[model samples]
Target: MTTDELKGLKVASLVDARGTACPGPLLAAKKAMGDIESGEILEVYSSDEGTKVDIPKWCQKMGHDYLGVVEESSYVRMFLKKS
Candidate 1:
């Protein structure tokens, strides 16, 4: 989806892993996913460039829906729906 579309979405959780490295953001997202219920959305914020690819791959492997991402000035907001 477009960044604007993602901005309008209501996520169940928001995990800010900005300023960290590759595995850091991914790990944060995995932990945060546990707090939300099935079918709920999880929004992850990260400045790590790898997250653009990592998050989608993680979602695919974990059986979740990879919605899309929204890029901000310094960070990107990634959306996923727990399955």
Candidate 2:
């Protein structure tokens, strides 16, 4: 989804994993997912470049909906809807 579209979404939880690396951000997302209900949105912020690819792949493998990513100067925000 577009950044504007994602911005309009009601995120259920926000995981600010910025400053973390690789699996750190991914792990944070996994833990945060459990706090939200099914069909709810999770927004993950990460500075780790790996998260750009890792999160979407994780969502795909876990059967969650990988909405998209919004790039920022210091970090990128990824959106996912839990299945």
Candidate 3:
């Protein structure tokens, strides 16, 4: 979805997982989900390359929806829709 469309959706937390390693982004994303409503989205920003793989796998294993990933100059943005 477009950034504007995503902006319309509720974001529980913008987890800045940048500079963190494996499991760190996932951990933060999971923690962020806890603070939001069930259907809300948790947006995660991470510099760790592992996030590209780990986040999706974690989402699958946890039964959450891995929306998509956006790449930026120095980091990547992962969008997760809580189920």
Question: What are the TM-scores, per candidate, against the unseen true structure?
Answer: 0.96, 0.97, 0.85
Give the per-residue Cα lDDT of candidate 2 at 31: 99
Model 1 agreement with the true structure over 1-83: per-residue lDDT tens digits? 88788889988999999999979999999999999999999999999999999999999999999999988999999999999
What's the lDDT for candidate 3? 0.84
**True-structure RMSD, every candidate:** 0.7, 0.6, 1.9
- Which candidate number has the best lDDT? 1
Per-residue lDDT tens digits for candidate 2, residues 2-83, read 7899888999999999988878999999999999999999999999998898888889999999999999999999999999
Angstrom error of the Cα, residue 83, model 1: value is 0.5
Misplaced by over 4 Å in model 3 are 1-10
How displaced is residue 26 in candidate 1, in Å? 0.4
lDDT of 3 at 22: 80
TM-score result, candidate 2: 0.97
Candidate scoring better on lDDT of 2 and 3: 2
Best by TM-score: 2
Off by over 4 Å in 2: none
